[model samples]
Target: MNPALANRPGQHLRIAALLCTLLLSLLGAGARAELQLLDGIAAIVNDDVVMLSELRAETEMIYQQLLRTQNQAPPRDALAGQVLERLILDKLQLAIAQRAGAQISESELDQAVAQVAEGQGLSVEQLFAQAAADGLSRDWVRDKIRNEVIIGRVQQSIVNRRITISDQEIDNFLNTNSSELLNAEELQIGHLMLPLSSGTDEQTIAATREKAEALREQILQGADFRQLAVLHSSGQNALQGGDLGWRAANQLPTAFAIALRDLEPGQVTAPIRTDA
Candidate 1:
């Protein structure tokens, strides 16, 4: 199964959940009064709820981090939606881990926390102090790490059960250009296709080509590629900012691989005609 497509159901659920929250937020003041006092439910996953406060905290943390790192951050609502979706997925995975009897002992949790501190070149107490300065409590950091460990364990177990490697396939892989394949570069491609029907007239075709060229020019001149894609793309992942996700060059179509061959990071390619 294609892992990318496998998450469609979850994606749908996330979109529905985000829209529901958005709708509630837009209701009259009287309707929102109770929600403001009691806090709101961002999403309901199985028996667990993702509270609005939790989502807001995560979203704000990420937003602040992005401000410190990237030149620009995604729109606030978009960032919140992404954060809520991730929380929902994490909650589902945690539930699965619980059912599968996956447990992380206190000692293991302490070790994990220590490792995190070591990675940051700080001692445990210093790490806690820094987290406090960053407005994150020690318990929050520990819980986040614990959940991550559980999720990782559950994902590995699921993959092990679902994957089978035939001896012949392994032998073939080892005998081939294995080193090159292992080191192959993966690219995150964003695409926006201006689709055309089989019987499209030359005039219409010309117009579409012109439009595509204009969009490419816009991207070259510092326009946000993903935003433009979301606004105009006719591709399957249009709603996802036309993201094709990370793909190995060898796994992509010959045309795409060739088109991307000489491009550097952040460089846009010239318009290429394709039969879509």
Candidate 2:
């Protein structure tokens, strides 16, 4: 409001424009800072990039899911790495599927979404609202489901191409193991490894076996497996509560499959020693 400038409407307008521009510049700087904090390239997967924001969102989703199931989430740093690896794998598989001309129809996507909603005991709209409350957008959830469907299709295609079962083999399998095969269910496995170094003495090996046995006893006595895993496991996923997630019976090692075969849910296997 300089007296001389106040007499000229054009000068006043120019000054007002200048103030507005300055305010916008300040605001833009803040916005840029926030964007930098919230989003960036987390990893490079061939021609694709995994964003930090995506990793965080997935990590949060898994953490919340674990909590809902009454299981403790792993440490953030560990969980983030696990989520990032999964994202990278998904990206790679999606790329492969794309090259193989794998496509998900709109109906397929919708069906998959519906199934997810049903699994969560929510309507589609309610699922969207819950996702939003959890800081995920509807588009993200849809895209995630679509990608999963694509991956599944591609994997099935690959397996079908690789495995050939003759009529004789099928008949033999049915005759010998039909009941087991028919009754087999997918298993969600957890692992905790107490590693032993190479060339370790018998005394050290015996000590490690004793420790493993003690841990197994504690688990059988109702101690939380995941808590103990986080505290004592030296495995790669130690921080992830030693969770191995779900696996098919065929996907597990022969010994593991055998050991888990007769076990009921929540039952722990006897400690099995292995060379590190």
Q: Could you give candidate 2's per-residue lDDT for residues 1-276 as a string of tens digits?
A: 588877787987888999999999999999999877867899999999999898989888767766665467667776676677778888999999989999988998999999999988999999899889889999999998999889888878887998888999788776877667666688998898887888989999899999999999999888889867766787645546788888879667677888999999999898876543
Listed in order, each prediction's TM-score against the native is 0.56, 0.64
Model 1: how far residue 182 lies from native, Å? 7.7
Q: Pick the candidate with the highest TM-score.
A: 2
Clashes of each: 0, 0
Question: Candidate 1 lDDT (Cα, whole model)?
Answer: 0.81
Best by lDDT: 2
Residue 52 C-alpha lDDT in model 2: 87
Q: For model 2, how big is the CA root-mean-square deviation? A: 8.7
Q: What TM-score does candidate 2 get on C-alpha atoms?
A: 0.64
Per-residue error (Å), model 2, residue 274:
12
lDDT of 1 by residue, 1-276 (tens): 778758676886888899998887777666768556867889999999999888877777666545543445677687776677678888999999999899899999999999978976889999888767768889988998899888989989987998798999799888889778988999999888778989999999999999999999999899988766645766645545677989998778678899999999888888777764
Model 1: lowest-lDDT 10 consecutive positions? 63-72
Q: lDDT for model 2, please.
A: 0.83
